[model samples]
Target: MEVKKNPNIAVSRNSSLYFAIGLNVMLLITWLSLEYKTFDKPDVLLENLTLIEEFEEDIPITDLNMPPPPPPPPVLSAPETITIVEDAKEIEETVIESSETSQDEKIEERIVEVSDVDVEDIDEEVSVPFSVVEEVPVFPGCDGNSNDELKACFSKKINDHIIKNFRYPQAALELGIYGKVFVLFTIDKDGNVANIKSRGPDKMLEKEAERIIGLLPQMKPGYQRGRPVSVPYSIPINFQIQN
Candidate 1:
């Protein structure tokens, strides 16, 4: 035989409704508390941004990903280089002359050369005219033989002497320059060359003319009234180009 056990259910249909309301209120309060306390739990471990997040705790995005930013660009400053050069220069020289007094600096006077005159001065005498001393011989020393032939012969001789000795200045010929040379001379009673000179246009030619004049030979002495007399003469020498 089955023992009959009494079923003990304290909630009755009328109280069931009140019990359900209380239970529902309790459930709501529990859910709210759990949500405030544990619903937001996340990972707190630092991690690489490249790695996947698999934890249930809170983790900051900043903490996980940043690479450091590249170490603030390395502090830098421009480098400096120096250049040096050596230069050369020339030195100038100065000279100072000794100072002298006016008197000390004065130059000495030059001496002058005076040439002697080549002619002799004659004395004049006054006399009463006497019978021309017989007109004796004025030509041949007291013998009045006026020899025209002798005069002509001497003139010819003088001409020959000049023609034979006349010379052109060699220096001028070598230099290819030419000119005329003039000379003044005196022919005494004894047809001789005297007071010879060269007053030419050029120095060399003048010298040559003088030389020729000096080379003249003596001639027969001339007579004027039985006495030798001096006579003036001239000579001309022409220079020309040589072959």
Candidate 2:
């Protein structure tokens, strides 16, 4: 059999309400005690307040008698003297030569004799594109080749030349400078490499690339329409320092 416990001995739900009421009562009592203990504030005196202005002493005016500044000096004008000359010679009129003279007249004839020039001796500058050339240049060791084969052989020979003469500059190698140097050179009508220009990361590398390109052996000149023409070629030389 289960025995039921007494509910009054346990905490009731309305106990919180009693605690709240007790807290409110304590606060009310503290406020009442504070109000009753406070004395009446002293009565504010209603005396009439008048603004008293400070007396400013009268200052005496001083009369300063200063002499007037002296007048500026007068400017003197220079005298204009009119001197008349007794005798003056009149200028004579000059006579100009007339340009309407006859052809038979004895006038000085300036002869500007120009000699006949022979333009045939002057070689006309001609440039032909290497890609569309009638006959491509042949490398020194690449003779006995057709046009297309000659182009391929020439490219191979140029690369081989660069490789054979490639030298990294000491300063560049020490500084770990490595880059591709574009070498532009012109193959003249005489088959000699000329007008070499190179651009690279450093001056030393550019100079080295220029030197290699300048060492290219003379080849047979490319011809277009039965006349030799200059051919511009560009090649890139890579300068790398092997670790």
Candidate 3:
């Protein structure tokens, strides 16, 4: 005989459905517990506000003792008799001379000679750029037959001068500052250097560069249109720190 009992008496038959229902109930309880919140009610005491009544006091008006306005000024008396006098003095008529000249008036012709007039010679200081000047400024001890040779010699001399006079600022060296400073100077018509300026990474370097350029000896002024003029020149000086 087969071992077949009643289906209602099978424990495992309804076990899966009971387990699913229990799981759903447990999930609903857990969701409710997580979403539920309770807030604490603060205790507040109510007090009655009492208003105090203010009384207004009356002020007595005092009259100021001002003197009455001064009496009107006395009227001036006029004479009853009027006298008529005749003035017999004659006034000379003023004559105004006309500034305009007529056609018949002869204008004096004066001859002006160029030699008789004073001619003042004014030396105007003119500035010219180095690159476009007809004759570049000549450095001392730099003699060349051609302009190109002169320029080369000038540049060489400038480099030599920078090397000779260049002294790195002790503060800059101590601060580990190194850069290239651009120096600009003007050679005036008197063949003297003026307006020496420099721009560098630091003021110390710029000051040192300016000092070096200022030490340059007098150079021959540049010429333009057969006239001496101030020439502006710019050069870069490198301040390097060697290891």
Candidate 4:
């Protein structure tokens, strides 16, 4: 008896769950049937249309009158008469005689005798030796009463100039270069120094010596035989580097 009472209670507990499952299955079947159904579409009709418009208005027409171009000008006529005259004469031609000497004539070659002329007296330029110059070049600020004294004074002034303007090149000093450079320069007739030449054991020393000599001021030109002449002067410069 107790087991029979329990059968209804077990069936009642599962009845609500089975009803929810059946309701969900029915809703899914209805959605699938609606999705798979096909329906016919309505036909669309189209017709072509044309519109006509008429406009009436009066338009005025005008005529154009043009004149023709002018005719060409008349041509000119030339005279048809011509006259002729004839004259006969002899033409005279003048004859010219040439003064050129013929090859048969003896050609005389004259010898030009040039006397013993001093080179200094001529217009030609020649460098005069310092020793033979009648008047030595006068240096600035050097006082002398005679040519000999002036030459000595010039020598002294040259030494003083070298001492005042001597400068050893930095590169030469760094290399410890030591030597004596002989610089030869010319004093032109214009009293300006020109044609500077230098010789030494090292090129740097020679160049430095030439630079110092070029800085010499303009002086009186030397004279040879009472005429101003170029004087060639040479001097020696020594370079010594101190440790």
Candidate 5:
């Protein structure tokens, strides 16, 4: 046997519809509450209200005492008009000689003697290495028979000069700086030592080496091909601490 109930009396028959309607009503109430706004009403007194008129101040018209304009500039006299006159003297036209040779022109065939040409000797500055110079620079008090002997003497003199002038820099000695300085100097054609340069481990050592080399006396200029020439010489100076 099947039991049947009436739809109006069933509790869960329209539960979804009832829930949907309740949810819509709640959403409408929330929207209305959120959209509602209140403003404060300020109290206004009709007696305190007044209309203001814009007032314009009248400034007095006092005339400013300005200095009178400077006197008119002096009138300048007009320059005399120049009158053009025709020159009566006849002008001589300058004749220009043409340097371009024509085909019919003959070239002169004069004999040029070697003796007729004057030769000027220009003393040009030439530098030569000390090793290959025909004649090495002669140091003072060095007398030798040949170039080899002169070179040996020169070396000996340089060594002696260095030994005589060698003074260890106090700063370098205190700093424990010691090294060999390569000194390059040029013996100019004037027999003077010039362009002294040095390279070492430290500036103090190099400076000391340069100072010693600067004391070298002027030497006889080197010779190359029967002409005096500048000689470039390089030597290493050892700066050793005795300690």
Candidate 6:
């Protein structure tokens, strides 16, 4: 057989066919590589992620049924400063004065308390004479009926009587008692003695002096500015037991 030659045409057809097949084969390999790589991707995470952790410590927890401990007591603080105080002392003295007249009166006035069992009844009685009061000076005897005259006469009469009968109390003499006894009396316009009151160391002495003064005779009446008037008077009786 004799060969007919189209060498360039055959070469063109075979080159085109070979080039298309190579391109398709290359595209298929790239797709298969991409799928396998995506399917086998590595699991990864970024750094600085805030991680949370849960733990169970061995510390014991109180039971709901158990009682709790008591709270602590409050504390007391010391004072910043202390103060001290001192008391002042005082001195005193007392003095007392006693009256001899008051002592005598108290001694005579005090009542003696005797037991009834120790007391005895007596049937006998004793009668004693009235105490003798010396006569007092006679007043004016209404000679000068003036009130001043009467007052002067009455005062003189009473004073004289008091002087004559004045005696020292035996107890007072023994106890060395000495004092002035006060006497009060009132004179009337008729020169007569009105009210007479006497206080002395002894009641017996006081009464005896009063009785003698009462016995004085009528005197010239007392006078106020030359007119008859009544007046009150006070006198002191001084007795001396020492001779």
The per-prediction tally of clashing pairs is: 9, 0, 0, 0, 0, 7
> Against the unseen true structure, what C-alpha lDDT does each candidate score?
0.61, 0.88, 0.91, 0.89, 0.93, 0.60
What is the RMSD of candidate 5? 20.0
Better of 2 and 5 by TM-score: 2
Off by over 4 Å in 2: 1-121
TM-score to native of every candidate shown: 0.35, 0.52, 0.59, 0.49, 0.51, 0.32
Off by over 4 Å in 6: 1-138, 141-159, 167-177, 225-227
- Compose the digit string of candidate 4's lDDT tens values, residues 90-175: 55788898899889999889999989976664577868888888888899987888888998899999999999999999898888
RMSD of each: 51.8, 14.7, 11.7, 20.8, 20.0, 49.5
Alpha-carbon runs more than 4 Å astray in model 4: 1-122
* Pairs that collide, model 5: none
Which tens-of-lDDT digit does each residue in 1-243 have in candidate 1?
897655565446458799889999999999998888546678799876796879888766674665666657777898897865446655567888767667657787999998996998773321211112112112221222435444444445555766788666667778877877777776555556577877767788888778777886664344345555555556566776767
lDDT of 5 by residue, 193-230 (tens): 99999999999899988998888888899999988999
Highest TM-score against the true fold, candidate = 3
Clash pairs for candidate 2: none
**Lowest-lDDT window of 10 residues in candidate 1?**
128-137
What is the model-wide C-alpha lDDT for candidate 2? 0.88
- Worst ten in a row by lDDT for model 6: 126-135
Assess the local accuracy of residue 195 in candidate 2 as a C-alpha lDDT between 0 and 100.
92
Ranking of candidates on lDDT, top first:
5, 3, 4, 2, 1, 6
lDDT of 5 at 17: 96
Judged by whole-model lDDT over C-alpha atoms, candidate 1 comes out at 0.61
lDDT value, candidate 3, whole model:
0.91
